[model samples]
Target chain A: MSILTALARLLIFPGILFAVPAAWFFLWVERKSVAMMQGRIGPPFMQPFFDFIKLLGKSTPQRTGVAGALMRAWPLIAVSTAAGAVGLLPVLPSSGGFQGDLILLLALLEVPSICIIAAGFTSRSIFGEIGSAREAVLSVSYNVVFLLAIISVAASQHTFRLEALAQAPATSLRWIGILAVLICLPAKLHLNPFSLPNAEQEIYSGPMVEFAGPELAMWELSHGLEWVAATGLVATLIAPQMAFWGLSALAFVALSFGIVLLLSALAAATARLAIDTTVRFYWQCTIIFAVLAVSSALLMRLRS
Target chain B: MNLWKRLMCYCRRRSPWLFHLNSGSCNGCDIEIVAALAPRYDAEQLGVRLEGSPRHADILCVTGPVTRNAVCAIKTVYGQVCGPKAVVAIGSCPATTNVFIDSRTLDGPLGKHIPVDVFVPGCPPRPDAIIEGVAKAAQILAERGDEVPEVITAAEVQA
Candidate 1:
């Protein structure tokens, strides 16, 4: 790819410009859908945008030292990396991606969690420490299933290029792999039944307990981008190949919103789980789905 | 005002996350607060969310009369919330100390401790009333966007 094309891909379409707006829209969908499920009129369509602006307008308390600098960097790193991950999506056909882009995408997606865990520890607040610890444990437990699911899909397709995977035909193994990925989504997005790390009722936003004003806004933005990246991955997997760029982009967004609605339903229906129960559940699913996915991929490979 | 400033004010009015602080009420006002947030009243329609941390709150909702034990806590939480914030004194307790006016363990009327922007008066105000109070506070927050935040100082906390 040419430098201009790469720059355009990274800074504009499917990147920061696209992801930021989509992030807010996804957040609105989650909140609005949950509100509807509870029989209430949710906030106006622009509520998330309003929130982001309000937070930015608020004053931030000063924290003087090394910890303060690290605290500021955490959210910035998270938002930038998450936006970068979103940019890796092959939303347009002939987007020109290279070999093993899937692995790079996965790495970019993990950066926000790493930043959250670090933010929790760096805050030095008791609640932040506890939240950080829970986040660390949860990340370790869920990533096993998460990574295995993606890797299984890649193995079945016989390629680690996301564009090739997107173009590949779906298989029974791929569907099962997608199911495993779906199971990991709630934990990754910190939604209900697995919202331990930032349980507002219990930990008051965990690693974000100390963050306020602009910094808090950044974290919120990072979270919104995460919703975009994770759901976008699933959307890419499920979305049918399109002949034109406009149709492909539209289909990709529609699929992502559908996933958002499905996840919102799941979130609204369930209650938060205990930390031990969540970890145990992920480990059990990891064992069960890992076996099924791996063996099925091997069998498919052998058949070919 | 410039467009950016106007946008800030508009956004501040549109989204008001609340942090509930019970200074010593008998949980009556607290229950009413929850009722306001519940689906029946659905304060979220007006962009009011019950936040866990004061840092994220745009409005500090203080219920009940301030008890001596809760005085410092109220001060600390008030200090924790970022600027462009408002305080809503819910129920008659926080506004006038109500029936606890003579109690030795009481230290409020919340206004004596922190500046209050709105007050919803009742022994335990209804859900609708609480929502109205919050909405009023949100408006106040919008106007206060450029003003300096008034926090209780270390000496005030020590006092």
Candidate 2:
């Protein structure tokens, strides 16, 4: 057997197992962090896992809907896609230059968001419709910044490979791009101030209102993975020096978990923004930062 | 795994799930409860989930002063819940009827209609306080007695 294939299988199994606990940990961290921000004690770090277990043990309510099958499929798709995205990440790369293809990573990252929207649509509840629409809007809104940042990263590295971007020498202008990425990170993770699509108060948990029992648990699991994957991406881009196979993997997980906690703190301290306000904030304020970061990267390249 | 269970216990301590019922109020406290869920208060981060149905909920959060029209619906919902339930009266109106106390159509001081475990005193309590109250309710639910309270009010039967 080829060494790469054997290694890939080994890595993928651990990666999938890591995903389950990572997601559970994120849920606990999100709660604790948000509580700290509000001057309140948050739930224990194991809360999400117990909640999932409890839900699994509980009986699922049968709902009358044509979208039942789709709803059932969505969470599975979301979690698997999120896992795939994690696999493609350069957590433990044998070589320095672009571990997994960047284009592939980006596409995989977008899958969970799309599946969430589909789950919402299948439910056919008003809240589900609202959630689906909001999720769609969020996807479109963030993609703009995501695409721009990806383009800038590729332009600087002269390749659309993650490892190459990592291997590229750190330039002062990369900070600007990183800043843009930072802003996009919270939105991608569905943290507050930017958490419109699943605003529980406004539309009864947006897309997840109708989901109960195991289905809800799956969505929750995927959410935790999303946090891990998103933060892992950021850590990789910024801290490329830590790219050794095992150590990089460990560092990537630790750093990403820390970021999720920080964002959770911010979410607890803040309030939800009006949908209109969030859209503008992402498009105008956030996009400006991204553009500036890319421009700076370009300037640095010219100087070199 | 044991560590996770402990952490979950801690999370449940901070972020309590709230099942909000509109027991015929002016929508003021309801709005405030919702405000607690918004980003400004963002209770969800602390693990405070808002449940639509009472059966799956740990805390039964009732708003309004208990209008005559809503008493029956409230009783029915309160009965539907399993043991280890907690009732949180979200406004002064429900606690003592506040300004709406004198209305002949009102039938409240919610405790008279249902066993209220926690009273979140406010014309409309601040979102943070509401979050605190729900946390208290969750604790109560965890320690509640095994016997379910029987329906005692005449108003409960008519509705």
Candidate 3:
């Protein structure tokens, strides 16, 4: 690919253009689905966009520059990295993806979380620090499961390239790896039971409590992007082969919505777990599921 | 309104995230606010979310008669809310000090300490009324924009 073509593909297609809208759609689905399950009529279709606009127009609290500038830029960094990950991932069988992009994606996924931690510490607020600490702990706990799940997929498919992963055969061992990915995802997404880091009741929204206006807008937008990227990652990992690109994309949307439904259902079904219990659950339940998945793949490989 | 103001009006009025504060209320008005937010009343349809932090909030929903002890915190909290914001005084107490007027320890009638843009008058206002109050506050915020004045400070109240 020529430089301009590659730049155009990266910048226009999967970069901000594709990632932003897809992220917003995921957020809309999340809100609408959660409200439906709760028997409420939810916000209008453009609510998230409206929120972003309002935040853009709203005034931010005064803080001195350079340090404040960098502190406030975390959300920007986060959303960009997430969108960049989406740009790297293949959405269809024939979609072009950069070589050895899997490792880059894995690194990109961690950037948002790291941003959260960094944003928390930079604020100099005790609650932000506490929230950051909890987030750090959660990250340590879930990283094992998340990495293992990814490794399972990589090992099962025999290549770390996303294009190959999408076209990879859907064997029984791969299904187990998919389950491993599914079970470990809630922590990454900051959904309920594992959503303690931002618990309003406990810590006043933790790190982002002090974020107002455009800062908070970016935070919300980043989470939205993370949802799209994470769900797309899962969809590409498990999607069945289709003859048409549109059919596969629809399948991806349906699969992501299914994931959202499961997410909200989990939110409704469980209370927030305490810090220790959350760690224990990841290490015990989530990790065990991941370990089982990897062992099954290994066991199958040995038999062959 | 021009295109820019119109857009801001739509966005600000449509998505009014609220931060609820109780200035020594009997918990009645607070409960009503919760009722308004719950699934049945579902103020969420209008995008009226109850946010945890004042920083992220566009509307401040103040309940009960402002008490002597709650004054400073109220001032601080109200100040913490970023601009293009409005305050909805829920229940009769914050409006006129209601039945608590004769109490020596009382410091309210909420307007003495801060600006109130809307008032929903009931001992404990209904969820519908509370929702309307918030919506009214949202409208006030949308139209007023950057021209909205600072909330009355504690020093000014003493003067």
- Which candidate has the highest DockQ of all? 3
Clashing pairs in 3: none
1 against 2, candidate with superior TM-score: 1
Candidate 3 CAPRI level: high
Point to the candidate with the largest lDDT.
Answer: 1
lDDT of 1 by residue, A1-69 (tens): 566777777788778888999999999999999899999888889999999999998888889899989
Residues B1-159, candidate 1: write the lDDT tens digits: 899999998999989999999998899999998988788998898988889889899899899899999999999999999887888888889888998899999998898888888888887888888888887778877876668646532101000
- Candidate 1 vs candidate 3: the DockQ winner is 3
Off by over 4 Å in 2: A1-14, A95-99, A242-246, A292-304, B1-16, B25-59, B62-68, B71-159
Model 3: how far is A96 from its true place, Å?
Answer: 7.3
Best by TM-score: 1
lDDT of 3 at A247: 87
lDDT of 3 by residue, B94-149 (tens): 88899889799898899888887887888788899888777777878887888766
Q: What share of the true interface contacts does each candidate keep?
A: 0.89, 0.05, 0.97
What is candidate 3's TM-score against the reference? Answer: 0.93
